[model samples]
Target: MEIGKLPNDMLQNIILNKIKHFRNDILVRPGIGEDCCAIDFGEYSCVMSSDPITGASNEIGRLAVHVSCNDVATCGVEPLGLLVTILAPVYASEKEFDEIMGQICDTAASIGVDILGGHTEVTDAVNRFVITTTSVGKVLKDKLVVSSGANPGDDIIITKSAGIEGTAIIAHDREDFLLERLDAHDIERAKGFTGSLSVVKEGVIAGKLGASAMHDVTEGGILGAVWEVATASGLGAEIYRESIPVEDITQKICNIFDIDPLKLISSGCMLIACKNGNEMLKALEASGIKASRIGKMTEDKETFIISRGKKELVSQPGTDELYKAT
Candidate 1:
């Protein structure tokens, strides 16, 4: 019913409820906040996740790859392959299609992943161009991490800044409009946020450091991601609003668009639940990744964001702020 991801309630009641996991090999099945599914294969587990690129038209191919791979990385596995499907409108040109494929290939190569076979077609499908990518990875059974593994007393860590993906998308897609209110340099810097869109490095680092749980900040921003992690783990969280990092350009863009930065899509940022916050932060810093301990998991089943001496309950994430701005 929404432009972005389905509401968690409807997703559970209408979709997830209908699907049953019949095999014992399914280490991880479909569930709220569980982006990647894992299947047991003897000593190792296969991890996979699929996502579509629908928000920005400029870097759809790059977005398609990173989004799905980022999901797989939440399991702390390096993606090795991708299955891509491309559907283009009737008016789409050959050059455009070639560019999209080139981007996909270049990005996959950069991540050291192979481009598995997939379908491509030009039809009257109601779209400019839609690309869906399914990233595949593998990890030892003992090393696998899931989103529901978080427990009470665990510290919540956020990598990078909030609204990283949204800022890049808005900066690139709405460049002309943003030029009216912002300088060219600012817009250029915001667009460059795309370079930081991968969470695989931090994901692996956190996983290796024995993080309790990991979730990539995607359709929902930092707040939404925290809510999902808490709900999935049957726990609660207390997030310090001021501790959540947000880039100045991202904040300005969100302000101009009258949207909440905390509720925007942020694929580059990773949400980690860990028992040793300082250790994880130090590990991330050593890897040249910026991270912050923003909160802690609680036994109480109510998620709250405290700001300026006021505590407010965080609601279920709906449409991403990126939709409104774009």
Candidate 2:
């Protein structure tokens, strides 16, 4: 099952409400629906988030840091530090551990984030190596972009394409299927999408352009990100299915797998809701990122999609096609 939001059950209620005396730090403003925790550090507060790599057998180290950093990017912040933990099965070899750390080090260095501290252990939790990264970033509240800042009539923009992360993982895990339907060149081209599992560059550009709300399209893809932005901002949206940009490789893989590209995971795509979407789109394009105005925030309080002139209401996503493709 997909990981849903943690319910305010008895145990969570005690920790989040009763026991943890929530303090209103100067910079860390406590709020519901924000993806990462905000810390008030006087001059500039820091944003912190932790995420793990579980779906892919390969690229675990590279993806773990980028994914968590993407959460920080959604707020239009630069990730400055990272804490990574590696959990491996007892049967894992030293070579595998070294390779994983190597990937993490290379990726972290590319992004200019320091490896602060983390835990490493070998256990029987599962068969594959699992990597988790907690990324910390700093941003002024005025410069921060929030998902809850979308407003009525704001244009919704998506960068890159849909199904980028999901299709890449699937093409890697299910090589047999891809080899049968796609040529070696096509398969290699598809595998190259691993490098696209980051939206930090695009997020930085959008944040500088003063985007109203920004979200990274991850597990639930572009549609899911749109829903979250709309819900968080107390707004509605009218999205055009045809407006979403899908790559040729993603289209081929999704067609072969019979998956809905819209419901697939997309890490490269950053969803931005902005007052001047046209200007933001131009800024992203100049930065070499493909941006599309897929929809507009509405006052109807309903999220709907238009396909072939027919409008269909959409609910929150479930059973994301990323795992299914794998």
- Error (Å) of candidate 1 at residue 64 is 0.6
Could you tell me the TM-score of candidate 2? Answer: 0.92
lDDT tens digits, residue span 1-326, model 1:
67988899999999999997778889999999898999999999999999999888998888888999999999989999999999899999999988999989988888888998789988896478999999999999999999999999999999999999999999999999999999999999999998899998998898899989999999889989999999999999999999998999999999999989999999999999999999999999999999999999999888999999999999889999898887
Instruction: Say which candidate scores most in TM-score.
Output: 1
Candidate 1 wrongly placed segments (more than 4 Å): none
Give lDDT: candidate 2, residue 26. Answer: 37
Best by lDDT: 1
TM-score for each model: 0.99, 0.92
lDDT of each: 0.93, 0.82
Q: List ranges where model 2 is wrong by over 4 Å.
A: 1-21, 26-33
